[model samples]
Target: MRLVIARCSVDYAGRLSAHLPLATRLLMVKGDGSLLIHSDGGSYKPLNWMSPPCTLEVGVPDDDAREAGVDAVWTVTHKKTADRLTVSIHEVLHDSEHELGVDPGLQKDGVESHLQKLLAEQIERLGDGYRLVRREYMTAIGPVDILATDADGASVAVELKRRGDIDGVEQLTRYLELMNRDPLLAPVQGVFAAQEIKPQARTLAEDRGIRCVVLDYDDMRGVDSGVPTLF
Candidate 1:
C-alpha cells in the first residue's frame, strides 16, 4: 500500500460531479488498484474513493497547472464505469509504501457466525425457490456471507449482520458491484439480512434496489417453538 499526505485539490467526473478544495489530506493507494482520499476527520470512511478494476496514472503538471502551484497530478479512472478521480498535488508532506501482505479477513462474532450458518441451512427464508450456493463466497475484496440463487436462477449475494446499519448496506453494495462485473454473475442481486435493521439502512438498501430481510434468530434457532426446522 502507498500512503501520501499532501496538500491537494480533488475533482471527480462521472455519473455526478464533486470537488474538494485545496487542503492537506491523506491519499491511500491500495494494492488492489483502488484509491481513497481521506481528510483528518470522517472516522474510517474516506472523503472520496474509487473502487478497484481501475487504473492510476501519475504525471507532472502542465504549464497552466505548474503556474497555479500544482506540483503533480494523479488520475484514477474506473475501468468499468469510466469514472475519474483527479488529484492535483500542491505539496507533498510525506510519502511512503508498505508491504502489508494478505489479510486473514474479519472474524464474525458468535451470533453473527451462527446466523450465517443458520441462514445457509434455511436459505428459503430469503424467499421461496431460493437455493444456497455457498457460505463465505470469496471475492477479491472479501467474503460475502452467503451466495444463492433465486427462483429464476439469478445470482443473489446476501450480507448478514447482527444489527443492520448503513455500513453493512454499503458493504453489500460493494460486493454486488464487484460481482455484477463478472460475466457469470453480471446481474447479481443483493440482500441485506439482519436480526434488526435500522430504518436509515433499509432506506439506503431500497434506494439502491437491494432487498432487506429481517431475520428472527429465536425462531430460526427453535427457541421460540419446539420445532427446530425453519418450515
Candidate 2:
C-alpha cells in the first residue's frame, strides 16, 4: 500500500465527469491497483476512488500544467469500464509505502457466524439442486459469505446478513461484479440472505436481478421457531 499526502486536483472522466479543485488530500494506492483520494475530514468513505482491476501511470506534468504549478500527474484507468481518474499533483507533503501481507478477513459475530454455518449445512435451502461451493470464499476485496452452484451449475454468490440492508446488497453487488469477470464464473448470480430484509434493499436487489432469501434460524438448526405454521 502506498500513501501520499499532497496538494492536488482530481478529475474523473467516463460515464460522468467530476472534479475536485486543488487541495491537500490523502492519496491511497492499494496493492490491488486501486486508487482512492481522501480529504482529511469526511466519513470513512474516500472522496473519490477507482476500484480494482485498474492501472496507474505516473508521468511528469505537461508544459501547460507545469507552468500552472503542477508537479506530477497520476492517471488511473479502469481495465473493464475505461473510466479514468487523474490526479495532478502540485506538491507532495508525505509519501510512504507499506507491505501489508494477506488479511485474515473480518470475523462475523456469533449469530451471523452461526447463520452462515447453518445455511452452508442446508445448502439445498436455496433451491432443489443448490450445492455449497464453500463458505468464506476469498475474493480480491474480501471474503464472500458463501459461494455455491445452482441446479444449472452456474455460480451463485451468497451474502449472509443478520438483517439485510442497502449496504449488504451493495457489498454483494460488488462481489458479483468481480466474480462475473472470471471466465469460469462469467454468469454468476447473487443471493442476499438474511433473517430480515429491508424493503428498500429488497427492491434494490431485485432491480439488479439478485435474489433474496429470508432464513429461519431456528428451523435451520432443527429447533422450533415457535411461530405457528400450517403443516
Candidate 3:
C-alpha cells in the first residue's frame, strides 16, 4: 500500500513499458524514502520485466495451493521493499509568492521580474521584438511592460499587467500615440500583455491595429518571434 522506487520487473508488453514523454518525467519517491534510478531510455524498468507474474487469489485452487480440505490462495505482494514509484514535478520558474523580499521596493521589482519572465517566455515562442524596458519609461501614465515588434518589423510599445484591468487600454493608447507620433521612438503598434484581456480593450486594440495578447502563464515556457508590436 506504500510507494517506493527501485528496479522492478514488468512484462515486455505491459502498459508501463511503453515510451513516455520526457516532460512528464519526475523524481520517483519510494516508501523507504529513497529515489529510483531512471533507465538509460529515461524509463523505469517494468515491475514484471524480470520478476514472476503477480499471484492472484482465485475461487478454486490446485494441490500446490491447497491445504487440508480448504482451498489455498495466491495473492500479489512485493518481493522486495523497493518496488513502488511515485513521481513529483518541480517548477522550473519561481512563483509569484516568492517575489517578496527584505526590501519593500525590491519586492515590487521582484514581482515585475516574475511577470516579465512569464511574458518573455511567450514572446520568445510567438516571435520577436519583446524587450523589457525599465520602469524609467513610466511617465505620468504608467510603467511600460515591453516594447514589442510585429511581423512587419514595426515596433510596438507594450504595457504589462499582472491581471487585466480597464486602465490598461487607456495607458497603452497613450503610450502608443506617443511612440507612433514622436520621431525619437518608432511608429509602432500597441499591445497589452496580461494574465487576461478585457473584451472592450481587445476591440479597441483590433480597431487600432494594436495587438493585445493574453499571455497565460502556461503558454510562456518557450522562445519567441522577432517582431515587436506596440500597445
Give the candidate number with the greatest TM-score. 2
lDDT of 2 by residue, 1-231 (tens): 999999999999999999999999999999998999999889798999999899999999989999999999999999999999999999999999999999999886437889999999999999999999999999899999999999999999999999999999999999999999999887999999999999999999999999999998878888876889789
Off by over 4 Å in 1: 112-231
**Residue-by-residue lDDT tens digits, candidate 3, 1-231:** 122222222112233433223232222333333333244463556222223322222234455424323232212323353232222222222112122335445345324466676665456533554444433265455556666555666666767776656667777888777666667567766666776777887887677676666665533544444457594
Candidate 3: where are CA atoms >4 Å away?
1-113, 126-142, 221-231
User: What are the per-residue Cα lDDT tens digits for candidate 1 across 165-213?
Assistant: 9999999999999999999987999999999999999999999999999
lDDT of 3 at 86: 24
Worst 10-residue lDDT window for candidate 2 reads 105-114
How far off is residue 191 in model 2, in Å? 19
Residue 174 local lDDT, model 2: 97
In terms of lDDT, the best-performing candidate is: 1
Estimate the TM-score for candidate 1.
0.53
Considering lDDT, which of the candidate structures 1 and 3 is the better prediction for this target? Answer: 1
Q: All candidates' lDDT scores?
A: 0.95, 0.95, 0.48
Q: Clashes in each model (backbone N, CA, C under 3 Å)? A: 0, 0, 39
Q: lDDT score of model 1? A: 0.95
